[model samples]
Target chain A: MLTTIVILLYICVVLFDFLPSKETRSTKERVIYCILLTVSFCVLILYSLDIKVPGPTEPIRNVIETLFKPSK
Target chain B: MQKEMISARQMFCIIIMFIFGSSVIMGVSSGAAQDSWMSLLLAAVFTVPMLLIYARIIKLFPEKNLFEIIEMLFGKIAGNIIIILMVWYSLHLCALVLRNFSEYIQIVSMPETPQLPIMIAMILVVVYMAKSGIETMGKWSIAMLSAVFLVVIITILFSLNKMDFTNILPFMENDFKSIAAGAFRLYAFPFAETVLFLCLADAMKKKDSPRKLYLYALLFSTVVLLLVILRNLFMMGPGMVGASYFASYVAVKLIDVADFFARIEGFISMNFILAGIIKITVCLMAAAKGTARLFGINNYRKLLLPVSLLAVALSAIVYKNVMEMIDFLRFYTYYAVPFQVIIPLTVWIAAEIRMHKRKLA
Candidate 1:
């Protein structure tokens, strides 16, 4: 049910927000927009399904830890 | 594209609100315990030179934002690499703050609801604000900052009865290392976060002094944050404050005026929302601007929705839970050093060199 809602919301966003302004955007703008939208859409759907999409926090934490180990 | 301009006063208000963003509710530098007040002061003092550098950068490049300045300074390949780092930083910061907002609401008020809905609602509002551009954001900050100040004053006044003066006794018990660590955390998270304002510096009128605007805002925010830290420390004491996740909210919850006025912790929530919106909007605008500059787009507004969507998704998965979020704060100071200090220092040096060369010519 949550997954369905997520899909519907993105659809509404694309239809209402993107489609209306499609004509004004340059080709590069459209391509970048679609790329961002698609990536976020996939991540949101995966999240809703409890699929555990990888986030940047873990790698960032690891890198910080490696560089600056906590003093016990 | 037409340039957006905000008065110096509006920029000051925006900076204050942005500094108060998540730090006020999260209770900055709690690692220093009762000496957090000292840590806060130390953080403000340490931030002064960095703030001056940021102001100088803005003065050097009056009409260009950070993205344009980077591209101009570094050229295509190197500048784009730096721009990508900055865009990631801005986007990640936006997501982190958004996650902080949702987590606070979920744990404090609405435990049953999932975080995605809260994040979505916030991103929508933030996107609208970003789409409106800096002028609207500046005006909004001016109006909302007054309400934020009123709430802070009211909460402080109401909670005065419960505040025990001795709670901060035996001050400076912690060693310099501990206090310095806490100060670094406070400086990285909130004080230096003002670096984001440089991304929007193009909006400030040429007549307004960036140095004056930044210093005034930093002074005002530091004082306000100090008062808030004192209030929390006096009410909750050092141990409880360190143990609690949301110290300000917990501190405000203890407010009782003859049993008639109580449970006004909602005021902290109000403060967070007002300030957090401006903070998120600023970050989103910066990220959108960076993305547009990367793709050679004229208007950043066209990318707001997509960037906002990505932010929402990222915020949803930023951490597994609030504990991880809080734990991340420890490492955040180090992670932020590159973007907050190193990059700006390099930019300032390069800019100085370029200016000197031009003068010689």
Candidate 2:
């Protein structure tokens, strides 16, 4: 599937971009960078697999609608 | 930490483009229908004080962006918390804009193409721009503003034939309360969204005054937006304008000058893309910079790709359909107040106090 290929391409690009610069950065920097990278990859992979992730907008929407509803 | 600085003129262009990001295409403050122009004008006038507040905050610490200012004022932990919140806000805004762009493109140009590829391609450009640094984004804004303005002017001229000045006749039809609410909605959106610019203030040259930059940009954008709204009002009237998702694009679709000069809405789409990119790029850059500061990293570019990818995914999942997106926007005026106004006002007051203390010392 095209989704699998796009996910693979993304992983390859992230590795190619970040791995070579690993030695130049501090451990803290590398950890944060990897954490961010891993998070992005996980989200994209989940999306490619057609797995739904709950978003934060829904709760905000609920609260707004409740608070601003027209009163009869 | 960006070494290259942009002149005030470049800042002006970026601000104008940023405000016009998705508003011009989607129709800002359309709650007032035919009177949306009045809403936008009132919003612009009301924004002058808020603009001064932002300018004064930056002037208080000429060398610092909003992130550094927060860190300095609030100390490390509290400051990082605020920065994280801001980063979240910026990413959320970027996602919303990306979704808007993809939806517009899908509806107008490519009906069959899946949104994933379009969104991926757009995020790629945004990541590259964010990685290239703030000065490059500023320079691009300068070059693109001329073309954007040219498209606006031409669209206005060509669409003049379809415009009916009488369509806007029965103004104030919504009563004073609704119009004021509409003005407040407009204020919360495009006008007040300039708070994000505080993140890029340090990128402006030392000689460039933030007040002038904000004022000039606000005034110019208001004029162009008024013209765009009038075109939509006169061409589509209040009825169809409110019914359509992208009112300006629909209005331009009615332009048929001598039957040879039709389908010129593509230029408006071009304007949309240019402004959208600048807006998203700035948001991504701000989020990345905030992340870098939070993690004590030297370069923000390291996080640009990941953050932008996150934004792309968020855009995909934000709303189920365009109608949902519009519905959220209708409430966005209220939801955005905390980030857009309250937080910035807090920072401005803190900055003023700090400045007074320094003067006394």
Candidate 3:
């Protein structure tokens, strides 16, 4: 159910926002837009499927801890 | 294309609302407990030098945004690398705030509902605001800031009866190190987060002074935040304020005037929504602009939807639950230092050197 909703939202975004401005956009603009949208779509689908996606929080925490351990 | 410009007043209003963003609801500098007000003050003092540096960056390059300044100063390859890092920071900050709001709503108002839909709803509004451009955001901030201030004042006045003024006794009980730590956290999270303002500095008119604008906004926000801390401390006491995640909301929940007027915690939620929208919109705009710069695109608006969708996805999976969300705050101060301090300071020095050389030429 969540996956379906994610798909629908992406479709709306691409159809309404992305496609309508194709002519005015340069080739580079179109390519970058599609790339970003595709990445977002994949991530949303993974999240919807209850699949665990690795986040940056742990790595960031680990790096910070390594660099500067808190006194408190 | 014509540049979008915001008046000094609008810029001031936007900065205050941005500072009040999640800090109002999250209750900043809580590590200092009853002495959190001191921590807040210390944080404001520490932020001044950095704010001056940020202001000077804008003064050096009058009309260009941070990304443009970076590209001009460092040239394409290295500049693009820095822009990507900044884009990540902006997107990450946006996701963090989004997660904060979703967690608050789910825990306080809707326990049964999932956070993804709530995040989506919030991000949609934020995306629309970002797409409307900074001028619209400035106008919106002016209108909503008044409501936020009124709600805060009303809450403080109504809770006066319940406040235990003694809860703030034993000044400096936390020791200097602890207070400094708390101040550092406060500075990194909300105060230094104003670094994002440089991304929107392009919108300020040529006549406006960036240094005065930044200093005034910082002063006003520090006062408001101090009042909020005192109100929360006096109302909830140190013990409850320390224990509760949403200290402001929990503190406001205790307000009871003649039993006729009660349960006005919703006002805190309203404040959160108003302020949080501006925060998220600003972050989203920064990220979209950064991404557009990365790809050499002229219209940042075209990237807003994709950027916002990515932020929503990240916010969804950012943490397993609210505990992890709160836990991240402990590590956030350290994680933020490089972005908040190191980078801007570097840019300022380089900008100053370049300006000196150009004058010599």
- Kindly give the number of clashing pairs for every candidate: 0, 0, 0
Q: What is the C-alpha lDDT of each candidate?
A: 0.91, 0.85, 0.91
User: What TM value does model 1 have?
Assistant: 0.99
Residue-level lDDT of model 1, residues A25-47, one tens digit each, is 88888999999999999999999
**Displacement of the residue B310 alpha carbon in candidate 2, Å:** 1.1
Let me know the TM-score candidate 2 reaches against the reference structure: 0.96
lDDT of 2 by residue, B28-118 (tens): 7448887888888889998999999999888888867899999999899989888998888898999999999999999999998877788
Query: lDDT per residue, candidate 1, B86-113, as tens digits?
Result: 8999999999999999999999999999
Residue pairs in clash, model 3:
none
What is each candidate's DockQ, to 2 decimals? 0.71, 0.47, 0.76
lDDT digits (tens) for residues B1-361 of candidate 3: 5689999999999999999999999877549888899999999999999999999999999878999999999999999988988999999999999999999999999999888889989999998888888999999999999999999899999999998899999898889988888999999989999999989888988889999999999999999999899999999878888888899999899999999889999999999999999999999999998998888888888889989998998998789898898888879998888789988998998999999999999
Q: Could you give candidate 3's per-residue lDDT for residues A34-62 as a string of tens digits?
A: 88888888888999999999989989888
Residue B325, candidate 3: C-alpha displacement in angstroms: 0.8
Model 2: share of true interface contacts reproduced: 0.38
Q: Rank order by DockQ, top first?
A: 3, 1, 2
* Cα-based lDDT at residue A44, candidate 3: 85
Q: What are the runs in model 2 whose C-alpha is more than 4 Å off?
A: A67-72
